[model samples]
Every structure is written in C-alpha cells, then in structure tokens.
Target chain A: MNIVVIDYGMGNIRSIQSSLLYLGVKSVIVSSDRNDILKADKIILPGVGAFGEAVREIKKRNLEKHLAEAVLKDGKPILGICLGMQLLGLSSEEGGFNKGLNFVNGVVTKLYGEGIKIPHVGFNQIQVNENSRLYNGLNSEPDFYFTHSFKMTSEDDIGASHCVYGSRFVASFENNNVAGVQFHPELSQNNGLRLLKNFIERF
Target chain B: MLRKRIIFTLIHSDGYFMQSRNFRLQKVGNLLWLEKNYKFQHISFSLDELIILDATRNQKNLSQFASIVSGVVNDVFIPVAAGGGIRSLADADLLFKSGADKIVLNSLQYENPLIVRELVEKYGSQSIIASVDYKSTAEGHLVYVNDGSKKIEYSLKEYLTYLEDLGVGEIYLNSIDKDGTGFGYDLETILNVKDLLSIPLIIAGGAGNEKHLLEGLKTDGIAAVATANLFNFIGDGLPNARNHIISLGENIANWNANS
Candidate 1:
C-alpha cells in the first residue's frame, strides 16, 4: 500500500515522515500535484504551524479541491494534526477569520482567561472515546504530546477523545476515513507511535 | 476515584520554544551535527512537565513575553507553569493573561518584598510560586534568581517564611549545580526547605532515574518533581521515555497493590 504525506511547507513533514518509517511503513511525500493525491492509497496532511497559514496554503495549491474530491468522492483516508486538525474544521478564529477544509463540522476557538492556557503546550492526557480505531490496543487515558493555541469545538462528537484543561476540548476525532488530532502524534511517545501505527494499519 | 493530577512545563531553548537543550554550552557544529547524528524534532508530543524561560532573561518588556505565552497554552494538555525574569505584579498579570497556570517569581519577592502579598491578594496564593535556585556557597547556601545571575543575601529559611507570610501557594525549589547533571535531586535542599514551610514545594534539577523519583516522593514537603532529561529520554532516539515512565509508575503501583 502506498502512503502519501502532503507537503505544503506548513507542517512537521520530516518528523511525520520519520515516524512512518519507524512504523515500517514506506510513505512518499506528496506535493501539490493532482495526480499524486489521486494515485496514493492513503493521504496524510500533518501540520504544525498556525491555522490561517494552513488554510491559505491548502487553497493556494488548489489541493483543497483535490482533497475534498479525493476524500468525499474517491474515499481516501486523510489525517490532520494540530493546524492540520483545525483545517479539517469549517472555520477558525486564528488571526482574523478564515475558512477550513470543512471535512468536519466544527469551529476553532482560541483558549484564553482564567483556568485556561492559550497554546496548551507540552504533554497532556487523552481520554479515549468508544469505538476508536486510533486508540485500539492502547491503554485507556494515556498522555499525548500537545502544542497549539487553538482547539476545535465540533458540532458532533464522533470518534472523539475528550480532555479538559480550563474547559473540555476535543483532543482527537474521527468521522469515516477522516481523523483529526489537536496534539502531534508524531511527537508523542510510544502511545503516539501506536496511534500512528494504527492509522497506517487500519486507515 | 481521584483523577491523576497532570503537570506540564514548556521547555524553551535560548528564547524560542524547543524540545530540550542545555543553555551553558556552545557548539558551532551542534545543530548540523545533531541533524546528521540523530533525528531531532522540535516539538514532539510527549511531555508531562513543560517549562518556558526567557533565554535573554530580560526583566523590562513583558508584552513580548506575554505574546509568547499566549501562543503556547491553547493546544497543550496539562498544567503549564512559567518562570524567569519576572519582577512585579504587572509582570505576573501579563503571564496570567498569556495563559500560564502558575506564575513562578524569584527575585521579585526580594526586589519589592511586598509584591507577593499583593499578588496573593489579587490572584490568590495558589497562582503564585516563589522560585528559588540555590547553591552551596562558602558562607552556607545562597538563593538567587535569573538562573543564578545575582546572589540574594537571604537564606532559604528566611525566604520560605517570607513567602508563607505572603500566603503564596507553592515553592518551586531548584538547584543550580545539579541542573542538567542528572545526578539526582538535592535531597538535603528538600529537607532544609521542608523544615521552613508548610506549603507544597516542587523539587527540580538532577532527576536521573526512577530511584530519584522515589526519593523525591518520600521527601516531606515535595508536591512534584520536574525534569528536562525525562522528556529527552523518550523522544531522543532512546527507548521512548513516556512509555518507560508510565510502565515504571505502574510497576510501583502494582507492587503497592500486592503489599
């Protein structure tokens, strides 16, 4: 099976690539090429930077249309991380306002004020949701690495892993072949590796 | 059932937030050598204690610092604490605005002396953490701040008593000589500080193994233990650190279950 990691210069591509290799999966880094998206068995859009930058890059490359058609029409599995996860939402309050991939019905909001931290950096616990293939065979309620300032508040809670900082936020969610993680799985330790391996094996 | 209290510290290299790097060393070929020798990723998702410090240690302009704090707290999943170059109530407020769970202040306690009491009045004692970095001096033990940039004349006893009077929540006690050493925590320091205050204290610097963690837990006044080496152990091509720590903790819990 051929796995393609999307490259839009807004992600931790090399680390994600290295992790896949560690999982014994041979994955190719895909660019803005239309043929590449259509050809791969699975596509991974791993991101690290701001939400607005990711949306702009996706639109600029016209890969947004290809991604929508591929996932909705072609039934390809696509996973997003951090900003990539926010991109799966319909919109975000990152800087001003911006549109997202809209694969999931959600909005990204910034964390602020008392009992709430903005970026929410470092390791945090993950409360596993029912029927989650992403957390299959792993111990329940494990710590996952995180680094971001925005979180997705989805309309529906499907394949959700909930964790509370100041308020309850979506840590990870899955709908059909589309899965999103607010934390970086590539940066997570053994549990993160298991998550990546699960995605490679099942997705 | 009691929920596991999670602690998060944001690790910063120089000024920019990074995974882990000691500040005392300078290597011309280190970055390139690191890239070539090992697979280094800047923000790996495996961290329990994340700490961010101003690499420059600039005390004045806190707006820029607050912006950095604002940028990191939204996505992280744990209790986040920040320390370094803080000197006033306004500085503490800026850190709070930026999303810090606890504002760790050291020299500011001595500089104004009344600021801790004022902060306790405004934000409560739990939010204020009096940070101390102590070292063995010719006279005795000296507590200092700014990563030991200046020496404070006050002894650990006097400082802890002063903070308790101010009603601060916890004491973040660090040892400069033991930092980045991995030798183990300064047990004597904990013993000495524990005698001075009834409030919770966190022991940082030189945590090398599970044995060290066990010792820290046994210490009287310690609330938690913090380490940069722990994160480096897992994400740094070693045998995944988080899994190892979790497994170690589980083993101890199980042993206690049988006992």
Candidate 2:
C-alpha cells in the first residue's frame, strides 16, 4: 500500500516514516505533493509547533483543499497526530483565533484548570473509546506520549477518547475514515506501533 | 492522569559517546559500540523519552552531531530531544530535520535571549528545553554553562525563574557533583526548586539504578527523571529498572510487551 505522510514543512517526519518501515510497510513516502497524497491508500498527518503557523503552512501549500478532498470526499483513512490532530478541528486559540481543517467537529484551546501545568509533556494513560479503530487490540487504558499546550474540546460525540491532565479533554477521536489523536503514537512505544498497525490494517 | 517520565540521556563528545563524571568526560565508544551494547532500538521501548546532548567541549560541529542523532534514533519510537551547540535557527532546523522532537539549550539560554525568544515564537515553548547544570557550593547552588566550565551569575532558583521567564517548556536540572556518581538524584536540590516553577521539571545527574529512578519519580512535582550514566543501565539494565519501577506501583505508562 502507498502510505503518504503529508509534509507541510513542520514537525518530525522521520520518526513516523521509520515507525512505518519497522511495521513492515514497504512503501512510505513523505511528501506535500497533491498527487502523492491523493494517490495514497492511507495518509498520516504528523505535526508539532505553533497552531497558527502550522495552519498557515498548510494553507500556503494548498494542503487544506487536498486533504479535505482526499479524506472527506475520497473517503481515504487519515490519521492526524499532535498538532495535526488539532488542525482537523474547527479553530485553535494558540497565538490568536486561527481556523483549522474542520474534518472533525471540535475546537482547539489552551488547557486550563487550577494548578495544572501548561504544555502537558509526558506519557499519560488514555481512556480508549470501545469503538475506536485506532485503539483496537490495546489495553482498556493505554498510554501514549503527549506534548502540547492547546487541546481539542468538543460537545459532539466524535467517538472521542478522554484523558485527564488537569481536566478531561479529547485524547483522540475517530469518525469513520477520519481520525485524530492528541498524543504522538509514533513516540508511544509498543502501544503506538500497535495503533499504527491498526490504522494500516483496520482503518 | 498525566504520568511521570523516565528519560535516558546520551552524552556525545566528538564522534564517540562518553561517560561523564562530575562534568569530566571519559570516552566510552563509538556509535557501533553504543548500538552493540545499549541495543537502543530494543531498549528504547522501556523509556518514555530519549535525550542526546552533544557534549563536545571544543570545536563543536552541528552537522556531525545531527547525523549521529539521526542515525541513532532510526527505529527508536520515542520523543527524542537533542542539543549541544545549537546557536541559530538553522542549527535547530538541522536537528529537527534530523529527528529531534525538541531542542535542548544550555549556554544559549543565557548567552543569547533573542534567538531563544525567536525559537519559542517559531516552535512554541513546548519544543524547547532549558538545560541547567549546577553544583552545590558553600554559598548556594551555582549555575554553570559552556559544558560546566564556567559559572553563571544566577543561582539555581534564580536561573530556573529566568528559564521560565524565557518561556522554555521544561527545565533539565543536572547536578555536577552527583553526575555519574550513581549515588542517586539530589532530592534535596530537586525539592528546593520543584515547587518554584510552573513548567515541567526534569531532574538529572545521579541515578545509579532502578531504586534511584523510583525515588525520583515518587517525588511530588517532578515531571521526569533523567540519567546520562552510560554504564549503569547497560544491556537489560534499563528494562529491568523500568519493570522494577512499575512493580513498585508508581504511576508510569505501561505497554504490552507481547504486542
């Protein structure tokens, strides 16, 4: 299968490529090319850094349109990680009010609670949704590495899995072929690898 | 719940990985030797994060260190933070392109505040880690930079506040006296500064075994515990240590080994 990792000139793409290769994926291409993304069997959107800059880059490369067509219209399975996950939502409050890809019904904002740390960095256990394809074959409560200041919040039932740092927030969400994870599964060890494998096979 | 982390720090000088004692470097082996001994690909499964610092004292090369980092973290599936001579955005870009999820800054945090601000503005505070190396003295904890050669003006507490003000995501506090001693983490020092900052704290420099790891993790307000001792947790030492730490009922991430 052709696995295309969207490269919008941000975040670590090497680790995701390396992880796929380790999982016996023979063809994994990192590209921002529209054709490459459209032609792929599956897509992985990985990102880090500021939300405003990431959204601006995506729009600059016309990735916003291409991704919408591929994932929404074409019904191709796409997995967004970290800021990539936030990008799939409606908007983010990182720098200022910035719009996202809006694949999932959600909004991104800074995590707030009494006496909780900002940029919650470390591995934390996630309460996986029973119907989550990305969390299949994992423990009831699996751990994934998360590093972010802003988190996605939603009232819609997008099959969201929740994790509590200071308060409960969306850890991951799946809606048919469209999925997004707040944590970095590529950096989450065995459970991460397993999730990637599930996305490749199940999704 | 947000779980604590166990970080393994690799100190690289020139082309070889070194075993550091009180900030003094002793060459251990090359990349081949490191792979043969540590089996990082397999052992990385036991770790929450990996930090590789280019501790090359003289004539530091960014490209060379980036190559080593890229090569070592090939199949290792963990958040890797790399630094040691990152002066410009291009240098930070090189490491990010190479495979670093976050950039570690020590001297630059003090020497250049503009670049630090720019990096924070560009990559957000979470992508930058402020590494503080200090030694307990007769007067107080004295901060050091430039690979522990010179002492800075700020005390440990004052320096941490400076890093926080600079918008660094995390603080990597290492004790020069306790480093590589295998004695355990300087808990007293850690306690002194743990509650002072709002950002995540990663304490380094004196973990000898799994028990030390447990002690550090068990402490309140510590986000992570880091160790750069190359020989202490060799082979299955890390895996065993992690298993022991988990067995102690500490709140850590658990993965299915069979998966």
Candidate 3:
C-alpha cells in the first residue's frame, strides 16, 4: 500500500517512515507535489512543531487543498498525529487563534491547571470510547504514552476519545474518512505496533 | 488508525533522582534496583529502543554507569543507546564494552570534528549518535556542553554539515532553550539539521506532550524525538502519549481499510 506522509519543516520524518516499514507498509515522504498526493492509496499529514508553522507549510506547499479533497471528497484514509491531529480542528489556542485543517469540528485549547504542569508527560491509561476499528484487539483501558498541553474540546460525542488530565480532553477522534489522534503511536510500545498493524491490515 | 514507533530514554545521575515533584530524592542505588526489577519484568513485552544517558559519567560516575550497564545488559535485550559526557574514543570504548549498542557523542563533536570520523570508522556509522545540545541565543541557537552552560558560536546548520562530513551516522539535536520547559521541541532547530543531512536525526528537549512528538516527526528527516521527564514519574505524560499514538495508529489502520 502506498502511504504519503506530508512534511512541512516540522519534526522527524524518518521515524514515521521507518515505523510504517516496520509494519510492512512502505511510505513516501512528500512536501511539494500534487501527483504524489493524488497517487497514494493513503495520505498521512504527520506534524510536529507550532500550529502556525505547520499551517504555513501546508498552505505554502499547496498540499492543504489537495489533502482536504482527497480525504473529505474521495473518502481516502488520512491520519494526523500529535500537532497534526490538533491541526485537524477548527482552531487552537496554543499561540493565537490559529486555524486548523477544519476536518473535525472543535477547538484545541490549553490544559487548565497551574500545579498540574504544562506538558503532561509519561504513560497513562486509555479507555476506548465506543467501538472503533482502531481499537481492534485492544482492551478497554490500555496504557499509552502522552505529551501535550493543548487539546481538542468538542461537543460531538462520536468524534473523540476522552482522557481526563485536570479535566477530560479529547485523546482520539474521527469524522468519516477524516480522523485525528493527539498522540504518537510511533513512540508507544506493543500497543503502538498493534495500532499500526491494525491500520495496515485495514488498508 | 495511525502507525507509530517506540523510543525509550534513560537519565543517569550521581547525586540522586532530583525531580521537580516535591523535591523528592531517590537514592541512585535504590532507584537502580527498582529500575532493574521493572526492566526484568516489563522489557520483554514491549518494543522500544533504549536510550541511557550517563548524567555523571564524566569522571566520578563512569564506574557507576558501567556497573549499571552490566546489570541490565542481559535483562534488557533491545537496542541500548548511551549518552552524556562522552568526549573521546576511550569513553566510547567503555560504553561499548558495557554493552551499549549505540554511543551518543555530543560536545566532543565540537571540540574535534575528526573524532566523529574516527569513531564512525571504528564502530560503523550507525553506532555513533552525535548529540548536539544548543539554546536559542541572541546570536543564534548555540551548541554547548557541561549541561548547556558553555556556549559555542556555531550555527546549527554548520555543525550538521561538519558532522555529516565527519561521517557521523546520526545526530541527536537537543534544544537547551526548550529543555524542561515542556513547550514542545524546537522544530525550527530540528528542521535546520534535517534540511542538511541524510543521516537520522533525533530531536530532544521541551517535549511536554504528544503534540511535540508529532511536530518532531513532521520534520523531513528526523529519525526519533525524545523527552526525559515525560517517560518516568513526571506528569501524567508518557502513558497518555504512547496510548494516544497507538490509538492514532489504530485510527489510521481502520480509516485506511474502510475509507
């Protein structure tokens, strides 16, 4: 299966590419071509860095429109990780009112607490909300690593997996072919591999 | 569902495990036994690349780190990477003998770029991870040593090229400005290095959330991104981050199939 990982001057691209290869699916990293985006069976908008910067690169490369069309119109599978996931929302309060990919209806806001710390790091449990193809072979609550301060807040129940940090925040969410998870499966353990394997098997 | 990779980090210290949490101090010896016991029970079940940083390995803690390495050598079978205060071929040798699968060299790369060539030649390119710790200075992001106290007037791109020419296989770019800040990694610095090299680059510092991980991964050539305080008894971080990634991978997998 061909997977195209969108790159826009953010974080490591090789780890995701390697993770895909390890899961037995080869992927291509593309920053500037429409053909590459159109040709791929699946599209992945992997991001790391600031929301504004990520948005700038996506728009700068002109991959944003094509990506939106592919996932929203064509029903092609697309995944956004970490900042990429946050970018799938309407806006984020990280720096300013930065607009996201708008595939899902929500706003990414900062975690509310002082002594609780800013970047919530380390391992925590995940309670699977409703049946998701993503949760295959997974128990109800599995330990997953997390690191983030800003999170997506939404009123729609069908679109998110909630995790309570100070207050419950959206951990994973999906809207039709468009889906986003505010986590890095690439860094998680067996649960991570299993998660990737499930994605590959589905493809 | 989305797919993800695994990265494990270790920090070694002589004094004690001094954390931001209530100024609690755990004796090194006592911590080692607990860590070792945890590894013995949990390691086999997970897929993670181990990263060991000898916080005090410079002069006093060398023997201590070596002993620690020996203790976990057999129990932890995954790839073990060691960093901190590595300056010479001799230091690299000690780490390798102690069963470090990969040796991370940081400040030494600046003192003498040729050391990178020598180490890579002896250990092969993959074994040498040239770590660069820098902070955003008024001048630029300056690489430094002695735990980011000393500053060197070198652009990150310049050092990347220098190390690349030296035949160093990988680079661990740590942003001192972001370290402990948990703001997320300095993607700008990581991208600068990623733009220049073909080698694997790991972005470190200021990873407060999975958002930082995603940002680090989005860089064109980054191989891995790491955070210290995230994995252990820090905030409710590591598990949430890992699980989120796993859920993301699962999301992509299912999305791919049905979509």
Candidate 4:
C-alpha cells in the first residue's frame, strides 16, 4: 500500500516511517506535495511542537486543503498522532485560540487540575471504548507514550478513548475515516503497533 | 493510572558503547557487539524508554553520533532520548531528525541558557530533557557539567529550579557518586529534592538489579528509573529484571511485544 506520512516539517516523522517499515509496509512516502496525499492509500498526519507554528507550516506548505480533501472528501483513512490529534479538533486554546481542521468536534486546552503536572510525559494507560476501531485487537487498558501540555475533549461521543491525568480527557477518538490519538503510537510498544496495523487494515 | 517507566541508558564514547561508573567510562562494545549479543529489539520489549548518550570526551561530531543513533533506533519501538555534546539548535535538530524522540541537554542547560530556551520555544517543553549530574560533596550536593568534569556553582536544588524555569519538560537526575556503582539509588537525596518540582523526574545511577528498580519505582514523586550498567542488564538481564519487577507488583507498564 502507498502509505503517505504528511510532512509539515514539524513532526518526528522518522519514527512513524520506521514503525510503518517494521510493520511490513512497503512504498511509504514522506512528502508535503498534494499529489502524494491524493495518491496515498492511507494518510498518517504526525506532528510535534506548538500549535501555532504547526498550523503556520501546514498553511505555508498548503497541506491544509489537500489534507481536508483527502480525509473528508476522498474518505481516505487518516490517523493523527499527539499534536496532530489536537489539530483535528474544532479549536485549541494553545496559542491564542487558533482554529483546527474541525474534522472532529472537540476543543484543545492546557492540561490542568488540582495538583496534576503539565507536559504529561512517559507511558500512560488509556481506557478504551467498546467500539473503538483504533484500539481493535489490543488488550484492555493499553499504555501509550505521551509528551504534551495540551489535551482535547468534547461533549460529543466521537468514538472517544479516555485517560485520566489531571481529570478525564480524550486519549483517542475514531470517527469513521478520521482518527486521532493524543499519544505517540509510533513510539508506543506492541500495543501501539497493533493499533497502527488496525488503522492500516481495518480502517 | 500513569505507570512508572524503566529506561535502559546506553553510554557511548568514541564510536563505542561504554559502561559508566563514578563519572568514569569503560568501553564495553560497539554497535555490532550490542546488536549481536543483546538483540536490542528483544531487550527493548523489557523497557519503556531508552537513553543514548555521547560521552565522546573530545570534539564530537553530532552527525556521526546521529547516524549511530539512527542505527540503534530502528525496529526498537520505544521513545529514544539522545544527547551529550549538543551545542546548538542544529545539533538538537540533527538528533531529532535521526530518530530521537527527545533531546537530552547537560552543559547546554548551564553554559547556554538562551539556546536551551530556544529549544524549548521551538520543540516545546515536552521535547526537551534537562540532564543534571550532581555529586554529593562535603560542601553540599554540587552540580557538574561537561561530562561530569567541570563543576558549576549552582547548588543541586538551585539548578533544578532553574531548568524548570527554563521550561524543560523533564529532569534526568543522575548521581555522579552512584552512577554505575550497583549500590542503589540515592533515595534519601531523592526524597529531599523530589518534592521541589511538580514536573516529571527520572532518577538514574546505581541501579544494579530488579530490586533497585523496584525501590526507585515504589518511591513517591519519581516518574521513572534509569540504569546505564551494561554488565548488569545485558543479554536477558533486562527482560528478566522487568518480569521480576512486574511480578513483585511494581507499576511499570507491561508490553505485549511478540506476544
């Protein structure tokens, strides 16, 4: 399959590429070209860094429209990791309340609570929903690596998986062809690889 | 619940991975030796994270180190943090491009606070790890930089606060006195300074066995425990220790690799 990792120039894209290679994915392309997105069998939107800068790069590279077309119109299976996940939401309060792709109904904000830490790092377990396509074939309460200050949440269902850091928030969500995880599945162990395989095969 | 992490740190010097002790280094093997003996992929199943440091004592070439880092990181699906002589944003960027999930900063944290801030601004705090090496002296716990050779004036606690203020995502507190000694973690000192910062703190040095890992994991306020002792945790040593620690009811995450 032609799996394209959307390169917005702000992601740890190598790890995702390497992980896909380990899963026996052949013909993987890392590109910002719109034609690459148009030709991909699956789309992996991986990102790291601030929301404002990421949005700026995506706009500068003109990936926003192509990404929206592929995931929304073409109905290509798309998975967003960490900051990429936050970008799939409705809006984020990270850097002056910038807008997201609005692929899913959610809002992103700083993770804060009574006595909880910021920039939650390390491996943390997520409570999966019963009908989660992203978590298919994985064991219960699987742990995934997380390193971010902001998290996404919504009043809607959105096929959400929950993790409790400060309070309960969205760990991952799957909405038909669109899916996003607030953790690094590429860096996460077998559970993560299983999730990625599910995205490639089942999604 | 957020599980505590077990990180296996590989100390590299001049194109060879070494066994570090008391701030001194002893070459153990090269990359071929590590993969041939340990099968890093198999051993990685026993770990939540991995840290590779370039203790190259002389002028270090980051691109070469980055290529080595890229070599070790393939097929090992865990977070790898690499650094030692990262003097600029370009150096840190090189490591990240070569497959490092996070950049570990030491002397850069002290000598170049502005560059550290720049890294934090660009990568955000979560991508930067501040590595503070301290030796408990009669004067007090004093900070050391430049591969544990030069001593800085900031007290241990004082320096930690400064790193946090610089918006570092995590603190890698390695005890120069206890590093690779096989004794145990400096729990007393850990307890004293553990509560000072609200961010995640990974305590390293002197973890010889599963019990040592358990002791550190079982403690309060520590997010992770790291060991760079090659002799102690090579071969099946890491997997065995991880199993033993988990069976003892420690909170380290269990992997489903090759299951």
Scored by TM against the true chain B, the candidates give 0.75, 0.98, 0.79, 0.98
Provide the overall lDDT of each model, using Cα atoms, as 2-decimal numbers.
0.64, 0.92, 0.63, 0.90
**Candidate scoring better on DockQ of 2 and 3:** 2
Between candidates 1 and 3, the one scoring higher on DockQ is 1
Best model per lDDT: 2
Candidate 3 wrong stretches, greater than 4 Å = A27-32, B1-259
What TM-score against the true fold does each predicted structure earn? 0.56, 0.98, 0.52, 0.98
Segments in model 4 whose C-alpha atoms lie over 4 Å from true places? B257-259
C-alpha DockQ of every model: 0.04, 0.78, 0.02, 0.70
Q: Rank the candidates by DockQ, best first.
A: 2, 4, 1, 3
Look at candidate 2 and give me any clashing residue pairs: none
> Tens-digit lDDT track for model 1 on B1-259?
0012123334443434433232352222223343344333333233344455554444444676666655554444233567666777667766765656557787777787687777665554555667777886677788776657788777877877876777666777777777767788888867866756665567877776656665775554455666655344433523243345556562111001000
Q: Grade the docking of candidate 1.
A: incorrect
lDDT tens string, model 3, B151-203? 67677778777877776666777776676566777776666557676555667
- By lDDT, is 3 or 4 better? 4
Determine which window of 10 residues in candidate 4 chain A has minimal summed lDDT. A114-123
Candidate 4 local lDDT, A1-203, one digit each (tens): 88999888884788899889888999799998999999999998888999988889889988889999998999999999999899999989887879988899999999998776777988889999999888877778888988899999999989999999988899999999999999998888898898898888888
Candidate 3 residue lDDT tens string, A55-151? 8788898877888777777778887877888888889876577888888887888777533433444345566777566657766765555556577
Regions of model 2 farther than 4 Å from truth: none
| Predicted structure 4, TM vs. truth | 0.98
Q: How big is the positional error of residue A17 in model 1, measured in Å on the Cα after superposition?
A: 0.7
